[model samples]
Target: MVFRIRPIIGDSFKRKERIGNRRARFSSLLALSKFDFEEEHEMNKQLDVHTDTESGLSGELNAAISRRRLLAAIGMSGAGMAAGALMSGGIGLAAPRGSVTEMVYGLSADCGSCVVPATIAELRVMTGTVTGTAFYVTDSGQEGHFYYDPGDTSSPDDTGLVLVSTAGYRFKRIYEGPVHVKWFGAKGDGSSDDTAAIQAAINGLAGGGVAFLPSSTYIVSSTVSIPYPNVKIMGSGSSTVIKAAAASNYETMISASGLSGIEIADLVVDANKANRTGLTVRTVAILLASCTDSSVDNCIVQNTIGGGGIPGVGIALGGVSVRCKVTGCILKDCGVAGKAADGVYTSGTQNLIMNCIALNCTDTGFVIEKSSLSGIIGCTAKQCGAGAAITNASAADVTGNFIDGLTIYDWSASNTGGIQIGTPNASLGALLNTRVSNVTMERVAGSGPSVYARQQGGKIIGLTLENIRINGAGTQGILFNATDILIANCHIYNTTNAGIQSQGACERVVIEGCYIYGGSFGIALTTGCTGCHIVGNVMIGITGQTNYGVYCFGTGTNINCIMNTIENVTVRKIGYDAGTLPNVFSSVNAGISTNATATATALGTLSRKFQIFDKDGGSIGFIPVYSTIT
Candidate 1:
């Protein structure tokens, strides 16, 4: 049954073919030389056909048939109405190999006196532009895709929504899915302003969809905002980046403002601060403002403009934002020089910043201020002004904020050091229950990263600083001005000042189960401090300092020092200021204690109250309650 394939509609369009075990293969006909290959092949194959539709062309066609004659007659004479019906619009054209196929791009060849592709934006779509609808049009007279939002008030040129010189097509009435930013003309060349082109893709998402950023570098001059809810824009990891333009004052590179369910992931944002000379206003790399239940994950953000604080501080949840998430991000070199800016800052309630790292920031590495019930966990900060800060000024008490598994190291003496919980305004009400635990600090400087809690202008109702370890070189140690506080299981070593100091008006503060080493005074009770109990501690003092194990100064009282071991201390184990009140002590011992006016044998000259015994069941000596001279 030798079947004949009627001569291909035209002859000039070369159609290459190979025949094997009942299979007909045709080479791409440069797109325009289109054909219904499946139907034509099936029909021909059913009849045991061979490659006989070979011909040569010399004449031209018209827009009446896709101009270049892509609409050339698919002559299937008697091949059945199925083939005929397919040739008409009843059957859709098969999609090509690639989603995007560029053809006859720039150079203009004439089609009968009219410059080919005088304007692609003005090309009449097979289906004219309609509201909130997607239509297929010719890509500069080839093939193209575009959707219309007649209500979109943004400038069309900026959006690239109405494209100019390009070529591609889409299957008519196909299911709409995530659109690529490049489809809207994003060059991603790392230089061209592709912000509008990319934003156009996001805006034209029909109704709440995703915009994919391919593995390319897109330069944005301003923030790419997600104004509506449930909009997601993602990229191909580090290979895909959105960079800030030179000298452009961008509040945020990518922003989700007043919208929820937005996701920003797997991308890099370069703020380009080296060239941002005129950037006066604050800068943020990415910000979710007043947005809830959104997320920013696995993003690498470098050189974020702090705008002195968060509008980003790299990535931020600002503007009453709540229940959002920022996780697995690396922030580097954020904040402005000679000014304060944080790596990650949030004043939003119930948000989370987890497993994130901040490096070389000018201010706090991560800040939770005036926000309630938020948490920062498993984070690290290096070379920052401070590791983390939790403060409340006036905007609602900073209550129930928690920081766990934080590591801060490598700070300078000139910087404000360590983790701080303070009230900057000093007038706010009780900042209730802020806890910092499982913290490790190494090579700390600038007041020695002591987990300082300076409760001023108001009161810290409940502060818990536990399971802290600070070591290897610092200027000072932990300072507390908080009330109803618990400082337990802390190991602090090698500070220039006292290991632990209580200042301001502190009450019911318990410092126990701690190892304090290498400081002038192991514990100092200072002005407005009272009701402090220091128990079960090992305090060691370095050489060349007064080295009192416990020293009270200024105005404080009701201090209890019990079950403590002091070693290598020069001054008395428990001493007080010349005019301060006497402190109570019990079961306290010292390895090497030097009292200014007393010695151990002085007990022989004073009245004896008790006796000490050796391990061999022998009476060692008589002990006295008061022995002053040594």
Candidate 2:
């Protein structure tokens, strides 16, 4: 629905004139004409009533009235149309057909061709299409890849090809026609110079194709770098090996900077020699920084230099930007005593660590820090010193990882947790929202508790545990202290203290549908914490000191506890304060509500509980603080 009005100029209508408020006038005239009739009837028939007062004769008055009526009707219908013959000097208006909509105007110029007004010009529109390449390396080396040297042009290898061009320059692939390359090193075998060939191959190729390395051992001395956009270094399965010699000058085997769309896969990397100068020159394996859309997959990286007082990493990335993935790889014997860090350390954005293995690391098996929107899935870690995993200063999606023989070093250090989250000294903002926001540990094997996360600076929010199985442990099965945690459908037994512990000022904690046995405290909630709800938890064993089927502390009038039972509840000498109930409950076995008062038949079913006098609660518009155990 559009509205339009135009001005007419010259002798026929005289000076051009158009009312700025034509729409309002048109609406007013229309309402006046259809005061007692339905809107549909006005469209089907004419009113046949005179609207002009100046005309004397009946015919003139009728024509003027009919013209005004027609103008009003056209203004309502042709709301957004362009001016036609009405824009010319003559007021020659076109009569409308029953249902036709298009309007055309033809005007003549004196001693010249007919000219169409700018307001009456026809509109035309056009759309363009864009072309692109579907697949890379298409049609052999003729169309997709090329190599040319202007300095040594025996004749342009004019193969009638559309060689991949960038800024009007040609590029070449390494394996197309390789003549000679130096030999450097290989893995397992004491001597093989396949390292030099690998480096040359990587350096020679255009930054967009794949370099294939057949099964062989290569001894490497110098570091090799693969840089920029869509490059891949591949090997013939895991049989390909690259060994690094012991020397101070030896640094990173494969490193990158400011790159994108790269992949390195299927190989073994070893640094076990005694003279191992060590990765001191950046001291990292497979380093990537400020890069995106890159990956390392199906490979083995191991560092064997022990007691160098330096930290070595199997696969480490730092401060990268986006989309870096590490999958289906192995990191073993990576961290030596006094000389190693984490087996795999990822600190970046949108990174993924999936289906990998870590073994015999002196430090942490896998550590993720300061990352965003990342995930770790279906990995396994064994015989690690600290633990299988540690996450801080980031938020990650972690699931389906097997952890065993954790906390192997210093059995007395209670700080070792299988899947530890949050730490004491970590920055509050750094550990802002970490702790694997949503996780499930299904059918995982280990000798320790499934998960343990404690926060000191900031609390972990929105932590969920589902279908977690714990076989053996010395401490609590799943100890979590943060804000808003949920543990459901968990079966915990064997050696332990508390199956699930929430001891802090944490708020909104829920433990439902859990089967717990053989723990000192089935579920412990203490400290100055408030707003806790524990319901539908099943505890099997009924013997222990200070045992509680469902316990809460540091709560006042606003806390709730309902629908929890113990098959065998131990009664200790220490008396517990089961304070006044603030929630509405039907009976002992029925459900309850968070909005209830003590000694009431039903909440909010009676008169006011209390009245406000001279003192207004606290400062202003306030309520008194609730007790911790209510």
Candidate 3:
């Protein structure tokens, strides 16, 4: 009778017990009192028990005598009541009779030999490789299939089991199944058509499915062709509306070309535009052309109908659309009057327009054309005609935007700024490496320029405007004509003109930590400004009809606005309300108004550590002026 079952540590049955020295510990009551079984079934039918040799009784004493005759035919007196009847009645495979009957047949004393699945359909046919601390499935009919890890005792025999199924889980297969655009006959009842039944249920989605748009109003009459690839067009949030019957033959009421893993969430794209009166062309409610990795979350692109005179874009990520995303969307009243409506339009490249909201647009309420490394975070543009328009973009990142009331349309005398960038005609290009941070423009009434940077035909290199906050600017509240520009920590107020104006042909300009009030020149650099660095600025209440808290001009014959550096500037109550007598520094020409000691030979390398005050705290000392004017 062969019997070899050694590895036992705790729960010692004391079979003459001598383990550590390797050997002796096998006596499940002397191997079930010497099990015989028809003389070992006639000596195992004349030996050769499939040749792993040593037969006759060495299948570990015939697996402890067939688990003591199946625990004495189920009366269960041993092997821990036959492993509590195979773990509360899911009794099936049984062979363990040692190591405390292999921990009652669920085998997992810290993964010594791993095989623990009492049920959940035997943990889904028990495969392997499961780690610790995260395994759930309490069998409400195998709820979302078994998952394992209870502090995984590592030994899934080297990475094997993968059985993970989600998204309407069924496990082992049926991975992503749920297409329902009313099961392909889509009649969300706002009129019927349902655009070929929601484009044939998004072309019968098979790759990572989910077309579902169930809560009503989907009368789409025309364009609805989401090409393909990993589609997901879920809705029901804003009651799933997708109106827009035929607003002029449809330039786009929902179109996704080229293709990439697309997604259009919680829908509502009305684009009714009062029924496109006469009709012409240019229209859009949601158009992603030449798409790539798309997404349009919490969607709602409103009334876009600018036909004939064209111009309506209410969400357009143009051809060249790459890395797209338009979050928490809501673009209103798209375009009407002379039609140039833009409420979220991107020429596309590394796109992302976060927390979106663009209202009353006719032109520019977020339009980053000719994109490159794009971004417009925490967005909101109101009463638009221009509230974020970055043309010929490059490395753009307009942050924390909140522009207001910028609709000064007289058919374009140019700069309708609440934030408008380049292209007066350098052949239309160049907004290079831009960044306008923490932007906030308020009450900006007509004439425009609450931030306008122009460099006719390319050259706004490495521009930056930080922590900006402007209130009531009708003209020039920060208008620069680029070249390595940087205006830091700005807070301009009540500007009628020049609260910050660095004219064209500018170079290496840097206006630091500003806070100007009632502008008519609280900082102006003209005649082709050169290497300027006006530091630590703070000019208060200069109501003296605007003269200067810092104004540098040159061209009294070729100094070409020399190297300027005005330091530690602090000009207070300058002419205090038209009483006239406040000039901290003004060097003009051709209508002459000179003082910097008569323009100090055209002022180059003029470094003034300035301080001019009034309103009863009189102090004016500005004599540190260096010269290098050529």
Q: Please give each candidate's TM-score.
A: 0.71, 0.58, 0.31
Tens-digit lDDT string for candidate 1 (1-630): 122333345443333321111001111112223343334322123222112322211111101122112222221221211111122222233222211111112122211101111124443222322222222433321223333323333333422234322222212211123555765678888889998888887886545656778788999998888877887787778888998999798677888778888888888988877788788777778889888899999898887654543333788888788898889988888766565567777877899889999898777788887788998999999987777888887745668998988998876533345888878665765678989899998874454545678766667879998999988546557887888999999998887788888767789889999999888888888876778888888898888777898888876777777778887899877888766664454453422232323335443446446877777879988756653444
- Compared to the true structure, candidate 3 yields what TM-score? 0.31
TM value for model 1: 0.71
Give the Å shift of residue 202 in candidate 2.
1.2
Top TM-score: which candidate number? 1
Please identify model 3 stretches exceeding 4 Å from their true place. Answer: 1-223, 228-253, 259-285, 291-313, 322-342, 349-364, 369-382, 391-417, 420-449, 452-476, 479-497, 502-522, 525-630
For candidate 2, lDDT tens digit of each residue in 1-630?
333334333232322443223222222222222112123222112212212332211211112223334334333233232222232353333323211112111111110111111110110110111011011122221112122222232322222211222222222221221211221112325475555556655654453555555566667766668855677776656677767755635657777778888777787877653456444543456767667988889989887433446556777666754788888888887755566556677766777777777777666667665665665666766666544454554333322222222222211114655566654444554344443422333213334445676776545666666666554455777877767677787777753677777656677777787877766777766665566666677765546544655444444334455555564557521123465233423223332333354353433423323333335445323333333222
Clashing pairs in 3: 131-152, 132-149, 132-151, 132-152, 133-149, 133-151, 280-308, 426-456, 426-457
Q: List runs of model 1 lying over 4 Å from the truth.
A: 1-176, 306-312, 413-415, 426-429, 444-449, 472-474, 578-583, 588-630
Give the better candidate number (1 or 3) by TM-score: 1
